[model samples]
Target chain A: MILERQLRDELKQYASSQQCPPDMHARLRQQMEQAMGKGAFRPARFRRGVMAAAISAALLLPAAAFAGNPMLADRIYGSFEQLKKKMTAVTMEQYAALAGKLSGAQAQLGEKEYARYEALLKQYVRAAYEYGNGKGYIDFDALPAEKRAEMKQLLRELQPYFDRLNGERSAKEVLSPEAFDRYIEAQMTYQTVLAQAGIEAGQRFTSQDIPAHLRDRFEKAEAVIREVSRATDPRR
Target chain B: MNEWEVQQLLKRLAAGDLAAFDRIYEMTFQDVYRTLSLLLVNRGDIEDVMNEVYVGMWLSLPRYDPGRPFRYWLHGLIVRKAQDWRRKAWRRLRLLKRANWAKGTDGWTDDSVLAAETRQEVLTLVRRLPYKLRVVIILRYYHDYTLEEMAELLQIPLGTVKSRHHHALKKLRRQLEERPQGKVASTDDLGTTTT
Candidate 1:
């Protein structure tokens, strides 16, 4: 009991001495104000209110105008398609640039580098849509056996980049080495899950086949990718 | 700021008052930053995570209950964001490793080196604990959270929290008692004292 009390007191003393950066409050306030100004920090209720108003305004628009001008609807649809294509192109460019950098670099990257890598990975699904011979699928099985083998070999070649990226990222974000190792182990488990489900790189799988925890991770990964895609969309 | 003041600020923030948001930021940034610094090794990442936490809080403020402790909610959000950052980092690293990329050391800033040099031995050991135990210790000692509070915050049973706390202290005690005199062992993860 005495030892525990002593340890607690020592810890309390240490905690009291820890201080944040002197400029943290000022910087955070600036960021919060900026975010609020941009509507990025708007409460959900405000967004919903705005959305409701927009919907109401749209409903009030003349139905006769749309009925008389079929070309108007066509134009809107065409513009939407064009915007999507533009977004896909931008996302692809961003991913390709980051992936190329990772491919060429020999050294472990900093947080910025790891963030770029993450943003690139998040675009992987979109890249499949943009680059997969216009078939909207990453048809690895469609390739000749030799080509498939080459693709696998290329993935193998990229493994070290992934490892080093993890090492640097783990070093940056995770305080505990043991926790970082568990994260790596979780990645391995994800791979095992994929293998068991007969899923290969660039292939999609049914969410139902994934374990619950792994499925959550997979969904989060997709969400990150989608978020990156939206953030980089030129039309946005 | 007290809970009542924070709640008032949050109410104004939810009403779209930028000044209220700024006030909340001023009141809570230190606590948030300190918590993040202890959790994240990379100073740059800590700043990023801190920004993310604020943004997340702002986005979810409508659902926040004024009756609840704002600090607890904010801490929970920070923990979740940090975990997300960690997972993303791990995923990218695993991909690089699978590609056979040679691992190299990241370049450190002068500030980071100085910070590492100043880290206390006990803090270093605390950081070496497994994640589950480390979080419990950090909350109990660093944040001054009660064990019951920790159990509720972590969504774990009280028994689990007590077990983790016990295991963490035992590990710390063993590490301290077993150290040889005049020979300080280097910890790679703590980024401390070893060039």
Candidate 2:
């Protein structure tokens, strides 16, 4: 009897100390309903390579026996193959340009600030690369209701760090010429890290390298990207 | 609705009675919401979680075993949903980093220690256990259920529930013995599934 009483008292105290404020329920229900009404949300698409592939494919593909009797099919597949080769070259060039830009930005960080900045950059790059290729990009809105809420909550917790990082990045853009040159070296170091990590250029970014603090942003972004990819992917 | 009537309404809900769904919501929203708020512990995240829990319950209603009590099933759903929330937030990782966040509160109105004066020390102690163990303790004592009933409700093996119950209670007793301040009121009227 004493044991039971002790247990109850303990349990009740736990409950009382944790009384959830009312009114939270109505808001959650509304969000859920609104999300449901919208159907599944997709993530943003950053698939330049795929988009390039599709664009070139469309431009060269009027080969059927239409009333206009366009380009013939004997050379269509060959042309697509040639386009693929050219597309690969163009993608590499674009990646180099972007990496150069990022490298230029990185060289300006002071020695003291280098560690944290490098860590954050590596984390974001890893996350972005993984998000582009893997299931990391998700549509939380389209996820099972429970999973969606869970991800959203996770995203909520991680938003502050991401906002800070973005603000810091913009602020660094105003550095003097010499400072900007050093920043480029740091950016190049980041790109090297990405390459060493086996994330190929010209593909969508992934989330594998994301640090814990920024995981929520990566998760939210991934979910949104996946939703967009699903909505836009021709194969889907 | 009373327990039996709620069961009948759930049966209708299972068979596609949208009105019955609304009835069930009215019947249990308070209970579910209150529990979710406590488990989640964040005011900002609670509402979305509550709606998700309800939506999950709605989707899973068809599979709810009729042999079990509806409240037990509902309890299971709530626990699962709370776990789901914890997982996505990676709160489990964060929990290990920080000393438990849910501790040392001195809130008004529902002042936990004051309300359960006798159990206060033990309650405070149990709050420090890991999440899974904490759930077992909460379902066992605060909500009041037998070891077997808890297992069924949580859809785990009976032996697992028994082990957790035994371990949690033993920990509580040890903690309370060390403190020895609060009184122990009879909990015979406490809500228990066995009753």
Candidate 3:
């Protein structure tokens, strides 16, 4: 009991001495005010409108529109290559912008629209994967004619929506450049630390391997990916 | 502010009074900040997490139940947020590794410098504990949470809480005994071995 008491006392003393910086409250208050002013707390009707727009845009892609075209296989391969390159080259700024737009879409989307978007994205990923394995190079001629035609139709149907979703116009419509830049910078720092740790893309590591400081930023960026995955889950 | 006062402030906040939100922030910022600091060792993260906590508070005010202790709710949010943050970080790190990008060595901040510089042996040992054990110890000792409260706050079983607390103390005791301090003795010598 003596040792336990002593340990507790020592811990209490140490915890008591720990103080938050004096300016923390002021800074937090300012941020809260800014967020409120930007309708961060308000229900996002604008987000629903954007979701509606995206859904309408997606609905316009008729699979039959490009079905059975021999040249369709080449087009699908081209589009998949373009998307892979775009995803690879996405800067922190672009990612933040994309993430912000996604969050808005998540907030506003109805059950039907969400399900549609989810199915479309899943189909797009599968098509892209089969076409090029998510890497840049794809052998268009190697695919059988019927399979090629189907892949081409899927790509033609999905590519425009993907482009609009990832494009700057969509991101800029929802996120201010300043917020996008700030989030991106934080993301860059997080990615840099992961690189230093010799962690590769899609590799798994325990939380212990992460440095204490970068964890928050790392988590924020991860939330973006998770949000996308959750929205795109076919089961959902 | 007392529980009653806090509830009143929360009521005002629910009614969209920004001043009440400010008051609540002022009242609880220290405890919230300290709790986050202990849970997350990185000083930079503490501030960001703190900002997130208040924003979360504002967004969640409409769901607040005045009957329960506000501090309890706040602590629960902080713990959940911290865990979520850690989980996300781990996932992102994995994703980066899979991409086969060159290792980014630049811009990594040294967090040891940001962690509390404690010379006290006990404090150092507590800090060195694994994150799960450390959080249990901090909640028990620093925040004065009872074993039941700790279990509830952490959403774990009561037996699990007791085991973690027992294990943490045992580890600390063993470490202290191993040190060369003459006055500090073993658990056997002190006769304070907890079951």
On DockQ, the candidate that comes out on top is 3
Query: Given candidate 2, what's the lDDT at residue B125?
Result: 58
Global lDDT of model 3: 0.52
Candidate number that wins on TM-score, 1 or 3: 3
lDDT-based ranking, best first?
3, 1, 2
Query: Sorted by DockQ, highest first, which candidate order results?
Result: 3, 2, 1
lDDT per residue, candidate 2, B73-165, as tens digits? Answer: 888888887776654331111101111112211111122443376435554555455567778877766787777788888889987776776
The per-residue C-alpha lDDT of model 3 at residue A101 equals 36
DockQ of 3: 0.12
For model 3, how does the per-residue alpha-carbon lDDT over A75-180 read when each residue is reduced to its tens digit?
2223424443633532332222233333433334655664565566555445445553222223344567787566445543433344244321332233455643
Q: What is the DockQ of each candidate?
A: 0.08, 0.09, 0.12
TM-score, prediction 3: 0.50
Query: Which run of 10 residues does model 2 chain A get worst, by summed lDDT?
Result: A61-70
- The lDDT of model 1 is 0.48
lDDT of candidate model 2 versus the reference: 0.45
